[model samples]
Target: MLRLAALDGQVSSWLDLFGPIVFYLIVWGLVFAGTGLFVGVFIPFITGDSLLFAAGILSAGHSGINIWVLAIGVGIAAFLGDQVGFLLGRHYGRPYLDRRTGAWVQRSIRRAEKFYTDLGWWAVVVGRFIPWGRVLVPPIAGIARMDYLKFVAANLVGALVWGVLLTVTGYFAASIPAVKSAAYVIGGAFILGAIIAGILSWRRNRAAV
Candidate 1:
């Protein structure tokens, strides 16, 4: 029991040292760099979800940062990213698609086209929950020439939902003593979720084939 108590104390100390710095970086990234990176056609290595989760854990402490502010900032950043991606796709996507010469490129285009045709606005909302899908769907919508007004409506709703869901989840999870101590459990779960998502995607592709 004493050993467990000591270990817990150690974990809390480490969290104290690094958590604030991580929180600051996450806030900065969400407000600035995250927007640009998420807007790109190529999916980035780091995603907004993990950052938001960390932000939640930090907020669980005496940190003065407001959760609402973080959510709003992240929402705005994501909205802008989607807008920029849409614009880029509107301007360059078709020309790039036309000039490209590869089966993979063509397949991706077809999938996007199908997503638009089958799901329409819901595609935008659903894509927001997916990592690569979130990155690719906005541009795909632009490529398909989806109506700008409809896209904006969907984008707003999607960003709001995504931002709130992630931030709040983290905040609540961190409030639990058991959860705070085993913080790595959260990260592990995220990784497992990603792996599961990948497997499902792979199975979907194989079934389609």
Candidate 2:
């Protein structure tokens, strides 16, 4: 009797009874939207790449929310989150940098200010793809007093592109069984890849210094 009650739980049965495709869309859509908002760019750096690849494969396999829609939703969320990050940088950036007495951050701000000055708007555009650069770029733009309109425009475009690319890659990865099986490996690789790329970029920029 107890076993039957446990087996008959409405929530479990409801989800279990639903079509797998619908389940995937609802699950991944929410995941994309929620994670996109709370975490922003970090999502891709973390579990985002694997999760997206999984979603893509599922979408390829069955009827689910259109991949384009998923991309747009996640993209918008990315835009909003980054906008918030930009605003935070614009308002609070100076105080945080000034109050914190870390040698690393100071060196970073010095380099960033120089970068922002020399490159003008491209710093925001290219920096979106860089790890710590993503966090630092917008604020640095604010600190350097780059044109508000230009900074916002670059940020919006970069965020949208970042969101869409990561989502699509996930979808593509899911399409291949071998790739799906290797998501754990791929996810780790993506993280390392981003880190390596960021370090290389930082070093190259430093060398140019």
| Candidate 1 pairs with clashing backbones | none
* Model 2 Cα lDDT, one tens digit per residue, 77-114: 55555566566667776885566456765676677677
Which sections of candidate 2 miss by over 4 Å? 1-44, 47-62, 97-115, 176-209
Model 2 pairs in collision:
52-170, 53-170, 56-171, 57-174
How many times do residue backbones clash in model 2? 4
Q: Which residue runs does candidate 1 get wrong by more than 4 Å?
A: 1-45, 95-110, 177-209
**Cα-based lDDT at residue 66, candidate 2:** 70
TM-score of each: 0.63, 0.54
> lDDT (0-100) at residue 10 of candidate 1?
46
What is candidate 1's lDDT per residue for 1-209, written digit by digit as tens? 35434433543454467674565455645433443454222323234556556566556664656667666776777788788768778888777445544675556556666665556676676666655557667777888898999999988877776666566566776667565435456545643554455456656767999
RMSD of each: 8.9, 9.2
